[model samples]
Target: MTISPDVAAVSTSRSQRARHYVMTRPTFFTVAYAINPWMDTTTPVDVERAVAQWETLRATYSTLGHTVDLVDPVPGLPDMVYAANAGLIINGTAIVARFKHAERDGESVAYATWMDRRGHAPVSTFHVNEGQGDLLVVGSMILAGTGFRTDPRAHAEVAALTGMPVISLELVDPRFYHLDTALAVLDDTTIAYYPPAFTDRARAQLQQLFPDAIEVSSTDAYVLGLNAVSDGKHVVHPAQATGFAEQLYHAGFHPIGVDLSELLKGGGSVKCCTLEVFS
Candidate 1:
């Protein structure tokens, strides 16, 4: 069939738009339940509010033109809501975590099952690792956390699994148990972090690696500001992190804050609830 010049131009325009949409869309994983801290069982959780906040986060991602996926939340396992702790995804392969604490050990199997069902080859880890909670992908390198929830030996396991270079950064403070609690990757070369969370050596490594990283304030870090997610453009952070949001805006990023205070009682906020699904 011979098409007219105008018709061909319109067809080309549609094809270009289709490609743009496919290229820009991002995929993420989430869970329905709120992960309450085992140490603080008495801490009250408004299940209704937590669910509403999670739904809002999902809606926000959907509105921003992204794919949001889910994993079933087990009744007894409260920490399952922090889906990022389940596994690390690289090149669409899942390296499922082996939890150090028995309380969250069952989560590994649940996430592994989901990964298998989702068409990703799920590989179980022999060493203790808390998935993305302790692993942050920056550029071509993986910044892994140690001296806290995740074990140092897991770095080698991750490197072996993904065939990517892993840099082990030790965490010192108990408050920032996971790497996600104190750091966020804004882009390939840039990151936002709270210095106090890392040990002296880890802080130096971060400075050397990311010279232009934004240093978040203690006040903001206390509210889990660094536990934010960015699409190399817009950043989703805690609503009360206004100062950090301004800094993000100055750094050529659009910051969107969604309140997750109810979930904070469980020692998590935004990033913990969202897991990146590698394509």
Candidate 2:
């Protein structure tokens, strides 16, 4: 029996794509403006602290031996510090985002320009989507978040572009606006999630898909424990999520903690700042 050329091509591409993460330096990072429920105009952000935290995360990825690519941060776009919202990239194809809010809409152009220069096929989105901040890839499936930052229409667009099935999950908690904040894809078969962040139906869907997933506690969730980044081995997460870190250790995973208190003011942490750029 022989496989068709199209089938063989897809198999080869999926097998060969290199794994990498994209980051934008928090050069002018701040929460001076409010867009989401997380940001408050009265709340002050420590720019120096945010940059240091971001640098640590970048170095953590470098120390883990994953390629850390940098995208130029545009002035006046303070939220660009959260690079994961830029777009979703898989097999060198980028599905550029169309932000639900005007505040972040300009980000799509910047990310598209970067993708073009990097030689990736850039596909612009029509419906509102906040990029990987609401889209997570696990093994061969995509877990997409909606009911807040991303629109359901964008999920279909993503599936069409990547040629993979997308499981749409509705977010219920405003604080965990993006799926990346409410859930973390630890490995091909494991995930860490906060139950309260998702609606009942969406929570059930996750339970069906990842029955043995690590259920994060409310305390951990408060500190953004679910917003973690893992390379199938080492997990980088917020230091404040102490209990979750211990849980990761007992579960046979190495968890490294970093303080991102400053950025937390803007409702983002480790995963928010890191975007996986699938080769």
Candidate 3:
């Protein structure tokens, strides 16, 4: 797909970085309960298809020169496969999630145990937080989300733990419950987002922070197009988000698409299934 002239003009070369990521195989992935809008208890999940798609995503990261670590899936915790929600790992320190919903509460401990085994200092939080789901690292700061899963009070806690400035962005739409679901960090200072997902104040903050950020179409946003992982250059995202992929390509990014349709039934995609381990 070709991009508009204005978009092409803004295209510039970006540096690529090799990253480390943690993932969990969908050994017990199923939608037996509904927490997010995309999830429905009545929906039948194809476990085999979900596993295959997750495998493809893992393989894609390996091909892109990134390291992949595995956290063993816990039985009966189906949503454990969405590893990003487990915790936010920054420079070898883990701030484990305090899940808001009881159904996913067990996943936090499972991930914390894995982090501890890996020599990461896992620290617990007092306020409710959903790890990378509500927290995104942008340049030298963290963009934190609230109004859905994470509590607003958790923002200051993350700032104190990481010693990084935290910018709280409130999510307004149920469909875009997490900051990662609505915004994809394209590079250290660049981002692509669905503006309507955030409140007016949050949108204003984003505009001031990233004036040239890509505004995604509503059609692509509904497909969770912004829920992507990027190592500065290559952006791994849902295969169905063709339009967003094109935008990434024109913006001088290598967009790699993978089919995670089965996992999407559980309200997660590429970024949700993968957690970046910064060191």
Quick one: best lDDT, which candidate? Answer: 3
User: Which prediction has the highest TM-score against the true structure?
Assistant: 3
Ranking by TM-score: 3, 2, 1
TM per candidate: 0.86, 0.92, 0.96
What are the clashing pairs of model 1?
Answer: 35-78
For each of the candidates, the C-alpha root-mean-square deviation to the true structure, in angstroms, is 9.1, 8.3, 1.8
C-alpha lDDT of all candidate models, in order: 0.77, 0.86, 0.92
Task: Give per-residue lDDT, candidate 1, residue 138.
Answer: 85
For model 2 the local lDDT of residue 200 reads 97
Candidate 3: clashing residue pairs, number = 0
Q: State the lDDT of candidate 3 residue by residue for 145-237, as single tens digits.
A: 999999999999999999999999999999999989999998999999999999999999999999999999998899998999999989999
Clashes of each: 1, 0, 0
How does residue 258 of candidate 3 score in lDDT? Answer: 91
- Residue-level lDDT of model 1, residues 163-278, one tens digit each, is 89999999887788899999998877789999988889999999999888999999998888988877777788999999999887766677899998877777887888888865
lDDT by residue for model 2 over 198-264, one digit each (tens)?
Answer: 9999999999999999999999998888889888767899999999997776565678998988998
Candidate ordering by lDDT (highest first): 3, 2, 1
